[model samples]
Target: MPIYEAIYRSNDHEELITVNSIEQHEKFVDVKNHLYCTYQGCTARLSYVPKGKVRAHFKTWPKNNHIQDCTDYFERMVTANKQKSIATSTMALSDKHIKSVLDNLKRKRKEQESGTDKVKTNRKKKPRPKVNPDSFENTTLNIVPTTGPEADLTSGENNIKEPSVRNRSLINLSDDDLNWTRSVECYIQNVETDDNRAVLELRDGNYTFRVFFEEFFFDNAPINFRGYFEDLKYLVQRHKEYLFSGVGLIEKRNEQYCMLVNRGNDFRIDDQYIAIFLQNASA
Candidate 1:
């Protein structure tokens, strides 16, 4: 459950009452029967102070009751999904944006790291960072221009274009080899997206998964990335159906949207998935 604190209306927004901006929610046993606030239209909290005066409090708002009704329903939906997602992180981008970004990234990165198109040129090595590639932030792509011939050699002009190049591993998935995959197997906490517009439904629960969109998309990926993206897109399209077959992704949502929100986990949005989905005009 998310930690809760007193929030007061401020410029038509729910601003947490804080001592030092480190919001410390007052501890209270969550009473299931009480009606919760509708997040659909209103982000404001209405009092149900007496422990069970929900119907009376709910009556205060006449125009948007469906928002209230959907509150617990959405919460339950999220909770139920969490039990299966084991989300290491969660994000909500539109369905189409997610697929486009992932398909582009996965395809490009696969080809780059796989090196199947590589000509094996004797390019001088550049000073490499010890950090894992997954840790490379959004701007790392911009830095490649200064990193010497390895970056140059990795560029698309270096492609060998062989039919055999289709068979190679992209992304180098070093984390999978370095025990991060083991960590990834478990749920992480609530994630914030890079944008402030959406929310992640189910967070870390039964299964946790993450993929960086920028890293996944690449302009230069050829055979491997192209093949991987196609395979992944197909896999996503039938993810729900494949789960019962014992052979595919466990995620749910429109094929594109799933990819969008799935990548949302990696986005640096207001620091959590819930906020991304719930809040607009976030910082």
Candidate 2:
């Protein structure tokens, strides 16, 4: 039998009514008369199945032809129900744990507040440097300064240029060098991913660029890159306003600049740098 937790009623202004919306079976029975399958062209009578060991829910009439052909059929509904059950269970567990921890912290805070009538003489506040918005305006990032054999290897055929006053920031990188590697500091504004590619949109003050990583293949099958992408996604989502540092290949498309970071490149969450940057930005 096909069952659901929700049904659509067109006569009462086309609203979806879930099992949670009604308190009694009699009310559900009343609404059931006006209810219809939300799927288009599906004429199956949605029944309020309140009996048996399974959870009470809405189900389609048995042996209905439209129910068999509908997109919101039995199998899909069961899958969605299972997913919802799991999510609900996980959230309940998380809520219990969080409540316990929060209660403990509140108790501790109250105790501390009650006992802290004495002022600590050694406490001090550090003065912050004022940031000028004009300093970031029209500013450019010079090539990271390098020394010794590292400098020589990066120079010459490696296409690495020395730190100069003339060089532009990563957002202004040109298409002249496709393989050139450069270090950049930027806040990741957004991260998006699909089956084959991950794109990161980064911003530094008023400048912005995108970083793309296409899926690589091995043994004729596409490798799962979700783990790597998830790690980046977690960091960006947790610290949406913080800055990150990475070495990336410069690319240009449609007269716009972009950077590409692959397995060989270095990417790091720059906590200290972000703190300074945020301080400066607010100053």
| C-alpha TM-score for every candidate | 0.18, 0.32
TM-score of candidate 2 relative to the true fold: 0.32
lDDT of 1 by residue, 27-85 (tens): 21122112235345544333322211111122222232234454332221222222232
What's model 2's lDDT at 20? 55
Please write out the lDDT profile of model 2 over residues 163-192, one tens digit for every residue: 321223443344544545544556678888
* Best-performing candidate as measured by lDDT: 2
Candidate 1's C-alpha runs over 4 A off are 1-4, 10-217, 240-283
Total residue pair clashes for candidate 2: 0
- lDDT, model 2, position 190: 83
